[model samples]
Target: MDAIALLELCNYQIVFPQAQTCCGQPPYNSGEASPAKDVAWHTIQVFSDKKLPVIVPSASCAAMIKHHYPTLFDTGSTEHKQAIELSSRTYELIEFLEPILPYNKQSDSSHTHISLHRSCSALREMEVAEPWLSILRKLDGVEVSLPTLEQECCGFGGTFAIKSPEISAAMTADKCEHLLSPNPQSILSGDCGCLLNISGHIKHSGDKRPCTHIARFIAQRFGIQHD
Candidate 1:
């Protein structure tokens, strides 16, 4: 939902789906598979109204809502049938945005230097970063740079980091290692969980805080256009 707010402003219609929910991550991850299945069934009921594509920012959640729910449902039930419909239209936010908002980076943007971070689950291995880069490249003098170990997890896997503080801290340290580069004028990421955790690590570990999020970054760059 972090990015959804801005997506609306970016010309994407927001579909406030019914029964759409937690993707059952908490219960499913907590060994409550039965409850997770219940959640999935409910999700199917909620979203059956419209066929608009479901755009989720988190890869983990998107994949679950798309791929996991059907298996959890009673296969012969009508609900299971509906689950199939939902999955086909589901997309990670970047996946949906990139193809829809194609723009020439060289002509539309102005910035020259930017460093991008890759989300852990979105490990389409930086493929997702393209949309963000495309957007930033349109800025009035922005340059896209590379983050160190951009593939590393920022250690905020929902509640995983909170539950395992030591391991989470170690992983955050790993994410910080690559992102601590001194030269990039700014840094950006698609995930807020990553931002909060990474920023915390940067502060605690003594790394310069890189700017974050393409929307806010663009909002600043397009101040006149917005006004």
Candidate 2:
């Protein structure tokens, strides 16, 4: 919702087809190819208009569609072609907005310090480096810092956490420890999965620092609120 609001605020038309569903990352990451393909095909068909760009707020989802979708279908098949075509137009929100959002020039004495947690997919699959930082820097009085082991996964590999609870918990513990090391006012990430894992662990540990997606952070900076 924040993502849509941010885009609309930037004067971009949002064609939200209610029929659109998940990017199929869960099943795909779990090694379930059949159901994953089903979801991918549904998504591709829903966003079939080749003229429009698909902007995903979540880097993990964007990586699934942009980097993994084509591999789901047989090479040279129609689905493969469509997947590749869709991948070409798909982009993560911050990455898409990095080159376009106008800088905030107004002088506001208020300050915001945030620790950024870049998801594994954002760092590795999307190959994006500090796009969120670049965007956040444009906002007046905003400062962004990276957690220790910024390149490491936050232990929420979708189904991985569900399958290996113990290992997941340990990784989450380590991740949260590093994220808190910077002691930023809030923890921000591009992927909700990371935010969920990090925030849940932190809250469980009695830490009150807010954890949220970058879209929401940016939207709030722009005075857009949603419940």
**Model 2: per-residue Cα lDDT over 1-227, one tens digit each:** 89887787777888989999988888898889999999999999999999999999889999999989999999999999999999999999999987776555233427988988988888889976578778887788888888877777888999999999999999999988888887899999998788889999999999999999998888877776433
Model 1 is weakest, by summed lDDT over 10 consecutive residues, at 100-109
Return the lDDT, model 1, position 66: 79
Give the Cα lDDT of each candidate: 0.68, 0.87
Best by lDDT: 2
Question: What is candidate 1's lDDT per residue for 75-185, written digit by digit as tens?
Answer: 877777788888888777766765544233223354446677767656663245666666655455777776666666778887788789899999888766666554676
TM-score of 1: 0.77
Mark the regions of model 2 whose C-alpha exceeds 4 Å error after superposition.
Answer: 105-109, 225-227
- Please estimate how well model 1 matches the true structure, expressed as its whole-model Cα lDDT: 0.68
Off by over 4 Å in 1: 1-11, 18-20, 102-112, 124-140, 205-211, 224-227
